[model samples]
Target: MKILDRYILTSFLKTFATVFVILFFIFILQGIWLFIAELAGKDLDAWLVVKFLLFYSPNIVPLVLPLSILLASIMTFGNFAENYEFAAMKSSGISLKRAMRSLTVFIFALSIVAFFFANNVIPRAHYKFINLRKNIVQRKPAMAIVQGQFNAIGNFNIKVDKKSGENGEKLEGVTIHKRLPGATNTTVIRSKTGLLRSSENDNLLQLELFDGYYYEEITTKKPAERKKVPFAKSSFSKQVMNIDLTMLNNNDMDKEQIAHTNTMLNLKELVYTIDSLESNYSKERQSITDNITNRINLTLSKPKIINPILDKKIVDTTEVANTLAERDSVPDKLLALFDTNEDKNRLLEIASNSLNSSKFVISSGQNQVREKIKSINSHWHSLYEKFVIGFACILMFFIGAPLGAIIRKGGLGLPIVFAILIFIIFHFINTFGKKLAQENGIPPFLGAWMSSFVLSPLAILLTYRATNDIGLINMDNVLLPLQKLAQKLFKAKSKEAK
Candidate 1:
């Protein structure tokens, strides 16, 4: 390597490594805050906590990569400017652009690393990190429980009877209260023997009862009731109930469960889900259409029937009027079979209500089905955002490197401050755009990449001006003209006064 090449490479590496370490520690500290919250008030071993942070490292690497690059470049070039190395190099016919060539190549390599980590390593590590957290949370009752306290596990309030390492678990005398919603009823269960066991699937606090009687009470708010309800009682032998104690006080699993979202899914899976939901929606729509058609056809194509009993009734009435209209001629059985006017009206009303209910059932089902399909369709957008926006890391470096050289100040001074402000704006816009896009106002791709698109050009413009030494805004030139004009006007006014 040439002396100049080595110089640029060394400068880039030293700055990048220093900034990367600082940012990486910040990431670890944030991860620890999250992990401690997950640990809750429960005691966990140091090794387990360390393992979680280690597993989380790859996911943090990609986000930190771009910022590290920005800071590193600014520092390297700023140092070069401050030391007059840049001026010396330019004097020897080595252009500013040529000196940066080595560092540019290094930045390109870092971009590739960012891409590889984001696409493959980070995703896999994210999955592993989630699974590891799940395992840790599900460890054992001892892991989830503090030594001396009342811990509410699932539907049961539990107190530890004894804890023995030799027995491989904690023994507890268990009391359970099961409350079902809507009714003022509660069942109380007591156990003489209980043990808390940690399994691969979940943390289990199992209860074994030699003999325990269950007591239950049901209450009602209604008054003026005629009868008293009977009380229920039950007794059991050797009852074993498994309780998930981990979820009693922790919300980590809830967040971890969201990894199943489509953002975690690859393109193929998202496509499959969308296709399946759309197909189901289509089928449901067709079914509703067919049902409506069938109902219409049934209503329109009714067959008419002649009534023999009505003809008989008319003949009988005519004969009765000829003989003695006032005489009672109808038999009870025949009269009972005849429909009264009120009865006829009621029958018509019932028929109308039945038809309306059938229509309503079909309409409600169609609406519910449509909503489900929409929900499924909305599920993939978040996954799309997380996976697609990751590509912006590489693009950010392109902009960062050029802008650093243009700014010509670094080392946590103006350049560093400028970079942070720019990144902050970029981050805010990206987040805001994502929220709007998720609600379907804008396209997902546009929202995710908007920041990079807007900032990259600004970087380029700055670089162009800096490279040609074309000043962006010459405050000296701008203010000097205004001052001279003011002086001339003031002198003219004085001459007129004289």
Candidate 2:
């Protein structure tokens, strides 16, 4: 390799490494802050927290890598352009494309590695990360109970108006609702103050209440005999309640079941899962159609007399006229169907029942179709995400490299600003497209590649401008119109003042 190629590659790789570490660390810290409530005051071991962060790091990599590449590329090329090294190389008959040859090759190789990492390593990391988080949450059930929220603890639903103290043991204005087994009544307890403590073995929680009222509603067996349901109420100075923590234990969850989620699958597994889901959806749709068709056919095939009074061509008009005359005007033909009140009631009941049954069938079919579509959309989105991440690395490099060269700025000042702005736009487009696809507004493939389609043209334009030694943007062209408009506005304001 030439000295210039080695120099550029080495500089780029170093910048990439530094930028990646900084960005990853920043994101990890942000994640910690977001989950501080869940992790802090849990009495968790230091190693466990570190392990959780380590497992979570892979999820952040896909986000960090692209941004790191953008920043690194910008800084690397921006340095060259600012130092006039690019001019020197250009004078020596080396084109911008030629100068980018080594870095381009390196980026391609990195992209391939990124693809494998995303497909193989990241999926396992996601599985482990999710399960570990669940286990941590289980281990610290008290942490799961947020202040000012209703929390379900076994058969009891507990809420607190305020929770304080170092371990969040002190509670004020507490309400507990306990469901009775095999009974319709609930036991409600309200406390002015309470203390929460865990057992030595951590298998149970003890709640001690102060100045509370206990109320229970009792239902009598003979509702017909009682004028009102009876209830029992009692005031207490202090009371202790025991809550079982077995359900919240980590052992309750099966690792295999949690690991089977779409986020935990590689490309091959995702494809297989998608295929299975689509197959099941197709079968369900076919079954639903067949059932609906059969039901409609059965309803159609039932022999029905088009003329209900076929046996009597000339109905007894005198009786019908008398019946209709009692109401108001006499309609002999319509009054013939209501020969008796019982007959009219039965006909109305049958019609109502048939209408309800038809509504139920239609509603059930629609719900099934919607659920199937959502499941299929999710699978397809996951499948496309695997390829998109790798491609994003290469795409971002093209954008950053040309942008840096055109702007002719280095360091964390201008380059960082430009990188962040462009990255934000890219991320927004990608997220918006995914949401649209998830809602079935667009095709999954198109949604997944939407960001690429939008940014590819910008990358090409930037590269072209950079190769021709054009400025990043024409400021004069933008400012001239705005200046003229402002002057006109100022003149109009002055005229109004005069």
- Can you tell me which runs of candidate 2 are displaced by over 4 Å? 152-157, 172-194, 200-202, 208-240, 246-259, 290-336, 339-357, 473-498
Q: How accurate locally is residue 350 in candidate 2, as Cα lDDT from 0 to 100?
A: 84
Q: Put down candidate 2 lDDT per residue, 1-498, tens digits, no spaces.
A: 999899999999999999999999999999899878768867788988887788888988889999999999999999999999999999999988999999999999999999899899998988987887777666766666667888776788889999899878899999999996787888999999999997446778889999999999887788763457678999999999988887676353325336477778899998899999889989998888778877666543543323335634555667556655675664655536588988888888987897888779988998988888887887788888888888999999999999889888999999999999999998999999988888889998998889989999988898888888776798899999999999999999999999
* Per-residue lDDT of candidate 1, residues 341-399 (tens digit): 78767776877897897879787877867575545535545445454445455455555
TM-score top scorer: 2
lDDT of each: 0.65, 0.85
Clash count (model 2, backbone only): 0
Q: Which stretches of candidate 1 lie over 4 Å from their true place?
A: 140-259, 266-394, 488-496
Worst 10 residues of 2 by lDDT: 299-308
Clashes in model 1: which pairs? 161-172, 263-383
TM-score of 2: 0.78
